[model samples]
Target: MGNKILVVDDEENIVKLVSYNLEQEGYEIITANEGKEALAKIEQENPDLMILDLMLPKVDGFDICRKVRKDGNTNNLPIIILSAKEEEIDKILGLELGADDYVTKPFSPRELIARVKAVLRRVDYTADEEKQEVLKTGAVELDLKKHQVRINDKEINLTPKEFELLSILIKHPGQVFSRDNLLGEIWDYNYHGDTRTVDVHVRRLRKKISEYSEQKHIITVRGVGYKFKED
Candidate 1:
């Protein structure tokens, strides 16, 4: 069997549908009907990834995502939000809450499976990158193996997502990557509906790094997305 995936949704048919498809892909599937159950299973099963629904009973997807990201143990766990809400704001909120991807209701099973594979691949890619030697630019340094960042030799803490975003930009300094490009690179897939996610992470990343480093390394290219300054 492949990696275990937790499927959380109040709808029995949706759960069954997704589980059936993912199982066909050789993944082990776990199911939860409500938010609380999802949280419990997340702790007990330690699923490799999660397919979460927004309007769950007992607890909501937003709270679940928030709690998961806040917890050090599961902060980096990959999450994909599967919701009926097609509103742009809902998509942005889901991403801002740390969801790796968002899929709306009535989605194609094939596309969902593709997204699952993509997210899993992204996780593998990030893990492989972590083995590389430390990366530095000016006074800022990133030790991927150690999962540490330092400015002026003083260590700083960053969320897993934040670190990944920074590492990608620093790895390709002076190259302008649009929001869609970044979503594909960092989230492991292109999320055309939720480009605001990139904006949110960029804003947070900018604020955190600014506190310790005087260099305005992350810059917006106006009509373009963002880039690391060359000099």
Candidate 2:
């Protein structure tokens, strides 16, 4: 009917609940009860987005997200982690592993749908913005057309979330974007209550790109937010 979403959860109730709600929203749903099956379905169905659970059998959701992000074929697929863990570290790990959004278990169906819509909207927005071929700042260069990043002439792997976060900062050097603002612009969801998601992605982006560039351009402004240092 609409976007195809892969729901991967070991619990039959969770899968049925999510699939039922998403189906009602006009989304085509594919269900998987284990991590390995989810990966296979991802390859076979090429779903537009994935709703993953952390405590999955055989492969686990974290490993699945990591593998998906590492693969060139499905690296850009949008992911939303649906887990029971509410720990900050768990959320951070999920985001760092390339999940676009994280929803705790006992989640509201309406809110999950909202997050799905936000992520897909951002995906469409970025695709349209890719018309601006190249973006460069200091030693870092981003080719939106190619969906690639090069630092000091050496290409480095970046998850889609990381690339989008860096691209936003590099495009507007020295501008401090508040966590709320950044969450809105980058995630396409105004997660004012949980700004830590932005911080996690920034941390991952800094660590990965720091190997090539001498300067870590992701500057955190204590209570304000973050910005890219002007080259």
Candidate 3:
């Protein structure tokens, strides 16, 4: 079966455009006009990934994200927030709410596709036999072979990008990886489109790990990249 993607948006045109682009790339598309319907589809369809709209009707994107995270069944599902809210706070709030990624409106179809492909590629589940590497930092645990990561034994349902980003840091422990290096390793992007993309993902990653530590799990280097902190 083609990868199923649930698109939640109040804009019909945006849905049509995104659905069309995603379909062209051989992905299965499921759509919703509001957050309420989006949650219903999320429960009924269990899409591999979701494209959520922040300014959704009725329930709103943040509410939907918070709800999904509350439900254990759909908690691990990857969410990409697609909204016109380009402000830094809006972006941070979305990521903090457990979204896997965020894309502002007026996005280029090509860039959007690239971003989608990048997210999907990271989430492509590894085979059962591949679950052999176990890396841990403090109370957090990452089993590379099992594709499982947990904090205090409570599994953190991280998207592929988050997994890769964390794995890179945890495997090394103290080595700080610059943002550019992280972009290359995680997103495989060579250019400097938005360096903040790495920063946003790092913030989300840190939040996911912080459930185990009150201080922080990932440490930031003021002028450089990021590193994993065991203490």
Return the top candidate by TM-score. Answer: 2
Model 2 Cα lDDT, one tens digit per residue, 72-186: 8898899999999989889889988888889997888998999899988877766777586898877889888777899999998886677778888888999999988888887
Report the poorest 10 consecutive residues by lDDT, candidate 2.
186-195
Candidate 1 per-residue lDDT over residues 113-145, each given as its tens digit: 988998888676666775768988898898877
Residue 172 of model 2: what lDDT?
91
lDDT of candidate model 1 versus the reference:
0.86
lDDT of 1 at 20: 99
For model 2 the TM-score comes to 0.94
Q: Rate the local accuracy (lDDT) of all candidates.
A: 0.86, 0.88, 0.82
Q: Which candidate, 1 or 2, has the higher TM-score?
A: 2
Best by lDDT: 2
Whichever of 1 and 2 has more lDDT, that candidate is 2
The Cα error of candidate 2 at residue 69, in Å, is 1.6
Count of backbone clashes for each model? 0, 0, 4
TM-scores of all candidate predictions against the true structure: 0.87, 0.94, 0.86
The 10-residue segment with the lowest total lDDT in model 3? 122-131
Residue 95, candidate 3: Cα error in Å is 1.6
